[model samples]
Target: MEHRISKQMIRKIPYFEKMLSHECLESKENKVVLDFDEQAFKIILDWVERDYTIILIEMDYAFDLYELADYLGLDGISKECITYFHKFTIEHLPIIIPKMAKTTKFMTSGALDAFICRHFLDIASSFSKVNRNTKKTFWSKFPIETIEYICALDLMINSEYQVFDAIMDWVLSDSYLRKCHLERLWKLVRWCHLNDKDSSNLVNHLRISAGFEAKLCSPRKADCDCVFNRAKQNCFVMIETLDIKDLRVKVLDNNFKLLVSQVIKEDTSIASNFFHDEHVSDILFDSGRRVIRIDWKQNKYNWAPPLESYAGLQRRIARSVEYGGELYEELELGEDIANGFLLLESTETFDLICFEGKHLHRFSMPIHEIYKRFTTLNNCEATLLNNKIYLLSNKAILYEAHYFL
Candidate 1:
């Protein structure tokens, strides 16, 4: 009994209607028939039924079928087909490459050359892993022109250190390929060091190239500690203008006093005394403005300002801090601070009072709002989060809660 596919079922198969068209199915009498086994025919039928799914074809079939399908121009396939075929082309290289090279006259222009080079590189890489048998096989089949092409392609496309090592091995084995590979390698090295400064490995590879001795040196010896140190130093210098010590000192001198004073106002006297040293600038105060004299050191009672005095000085400071005690009742009712000035939790909202220096001012919005407005208007980010609001600008000023009332 013969297995029969109904016309209706065949019609339901994707691409079957197109295949059944006279232009596709009709065979010319004079045309030579390409032999395909029963399994190959089944694969073709599956390819047709699947509506030429690129991923499926790539995963399921051999490279030759994939190439044929790609050449046939099934919609939504190109790069993936090339990439998939690339793997199989590498795997069955020994059989495929020599055939193509012998029949180069019949092959498409540059196709044989590309196949030869790609397989030569693959075989060379394989030889590096196995014994002399593999090495002899690779050497016997490898063409001089193909070796040079592999070296060129390796330099052009291979970014990984391991791949580079394999290519370099092939390069150093032959004098002609070595010189050509070196020329390409030099260009790649210079491009990596000068243009792509982020490629630390490439820079390291360049250093390896300088000291590499093909006969005696192990490939792993390419990782020279001294070269890495030099590359790291060069990388550091390229990106960082200031020394680490200078950066630390500047950052500490800029934000340290402000952070300390904001967190601990009771310890303000210590910071104040520290700031009096000629080298230390009063960062808390506006630059070029005379420091206000507060007799906190002399009077024990004056260590903390009265709430009434704080209220009086609210307008002098740019921002005010709210003690947990003052907002405890409001917070308990569920209100969140917003825009630096407004506090909204559940149903209640209120504007905050911000103070700059001795002046107290009622802000229509929160400190965050004022900061956003200032940043938007000036096109800059200018909020320092500490115990107090530290206004970072041409003239830095620390706004304390006591000053804001």
Candidate 2:
């Protein structure tokens, strides 16, 4: 069986153009036996025949189409394939990664490989509680270089021990074939991020293993205590009512599990207070522009410069929000309060503007109307805590806006 395609359509594909050129033997003979995925080739021919317009593509055939398009130097089809793959969720990773691992060329492109590396932590966390054998073999399909890249990433969200465990699991999946690469991958682990117990465990493992030596290396640049602690610490909310001495505090983890709840009676007077993830502080804003932070736990005081005074030290704490913008130009509106949202407060209304640069919040409801769903509004103060909006009132009432999540 043979299919006839116009010369104009054939010229659109680089492979066909070059093969059917005047200098080629196929052009002189006016016929050529081409070897390629027949289905993908037919799709390409249909696309070209229709004046190179975009066509609906089946996701199942995208991989094969992408490979043929790449071989034929069709940027349009390759881009379409990449766009389709970009929407893959965690469930699709196990299947997609193994297919991608079949060729090193896929890893070199940085399009799909970088996506996998960036979301590797999420993917691993998702499978942390699966069957032991499944967890151990989850990354066995990853190529050596891809694994090496992920191993060396500045991933401070989890402990280095998890990273080490992941690498070991991948290696032990097929020890006879993978054990030789273990030493090389082991060196990429940031040993400084390991806890005392994990460090000791690694030392014990090395004592038993052959051809391995410990090397001293600096911690990964992202292993700073601030970042490490941020990843480990849960969000905390400190509620202050009109009664200055009575304060309530609650700590919640990422999943909104309440870890701690306490009520403290103190002689201290309240001013402009800053609610942080770890502690509560009564900040003193003065003429000198100095901000004093009080550690509620130890009753210790520390003085730091006002963050707004220095350009580099400025934080996103917007007090007001303004709206006006056109296409391609977003009018800079309010400052950041929490998680990139601006709190819009007024006498009649209180609302949050979900700030996405260039993509402004198009709709807003009255703040008091929103408050009606949770609690009665009576001179309430709003602040971001634990990734939710806390509406505190003078009557010692606490209301949480879970819609933020």
Candidate 3:
């Protein structure tokens, strides 16, 4: 059987080069015989010749091909296998990982294992008996390496009790057999973060394994999720500043560091004092249309589209704007409420939300009495959503204004 594979195909494969260099092939008469799996070699041969689409390759087929590539010292193909597997497993893991969890051959790839841990936590929580009705979980079926990898990602785990519950549900699935991994898996749980009730329950389950509460109390390094989560803060951007006599919006990061000063319009004096008054408040980010709506009193609204927005993502604040130009324009809602205002998209009436003194009620709406009760005052913050007014105060949400029959 002439395989017809060229020398170029094997050039990058070190194992075959070694065999030829050492004259390991059996020579009889005028021919040489090199023994190997014909089918595996055929697949590898085809792959070496650029014969197949990389994305369409099946996981199991790719796995077998990877093994053969590794054995044959096909470094190029082996590297491609790893990069593809990392992507394939993420997209296909919920269907494949359950079966792979019990197989040691598939568990050793560090990249595959780490991707599993990061994306599979929420899916794993569903198997915790309380979240669903299942006798067993894919989480419990995972190999020791996977269990440790999952446990190590504390930052990704939203609630410690969820992990504890998942581990408990795993052990309880079939304690006689599943408990075999408990001794190893229990050590990885972040016990200190659990509530006392959960801690007590776990302690009871493990008995002497949890030697002391103080033992697990040492804080581990926070993961990227934890660090990035704390980076969030409320940023108030000023629409105008006196120093430059130009319209500017200053952005501040969580640390109060000046990120950038966006020039909204060149000359602020060209516009009347209405646009520059310090009394101006409230801004609504219209992510759907990539526009920002700023309001002052109830007379009208100023609008500007973000400098960047995407087809499937929320828009961010625009870095610059030209007042009264195409990107920046004004919309008049014709109301007198200065507290705050929200525009109901594609609707005629604007829901004017007003707040004075200590008490606030969304039902104190003005559709019946015109804009008289809450006429033109500057105190509350407001936003429009689904054509309803989401009223807000400095510390908390006041209420969502709704019209009733």
Count the clashes in each prediction: 30, 1, 5
Candidate 3 segments whose C-alpha is farther than 4 A from its true place:
1-64, 67-117, 126-137, 193-198, 208-405
Give the TM-score ranking, best first: 2, 3, 1
Q: Write the per-residue lDDT of candidate 2 for residues 1-405, one digit (tens) a residue.
A: 477877767887888888876588778767767677688778887888888886556654667778888888988888888766544443444445446555523233233444444335433433222232333333565678667766655543446666777777778778889888887888766676667677778967855663576653544555433233312532545344336445555557777788866665543343222223234453422221345545567544444444322211111111111211111213332332222333332211223434244343321222222222332122434554444455444555665554331
Q: What is the TM-score of each candidate against the true structure?
A: 0.23, 0.38, 0.37
In model 1, the Cα lDDT at residue 329 comes to: 17
Better of 1 and 3 by lDDT: 3
Model 3 RMSD to the real structure? 17.0
The parts of candidate 1 lying over 4 Å away from their true place are: 1-15, 19-39, 47-63, 67-73, 77-80, 88-90, 98-111, 114-405
Q: For this target, which candidate reaches the highest lDDT against the unseen true structure?
A: 2
Best-to-worst lDDT order: 2, 3, 1
Question: lDDT (0-100) at residue 269 of candidate 1?
Answer: 45
lDDT of each: 0.32, 0.50, 0.44
lDDT of 3 by residue, 88-184 (tens): 3222444454444443344433434433333344335322232223434445565555555556553344456556666666666667776667766
Regarding lDDT, does 2 or 3 come out ahead?
2
Higher-lDDT candidate of 1 and 2: 2
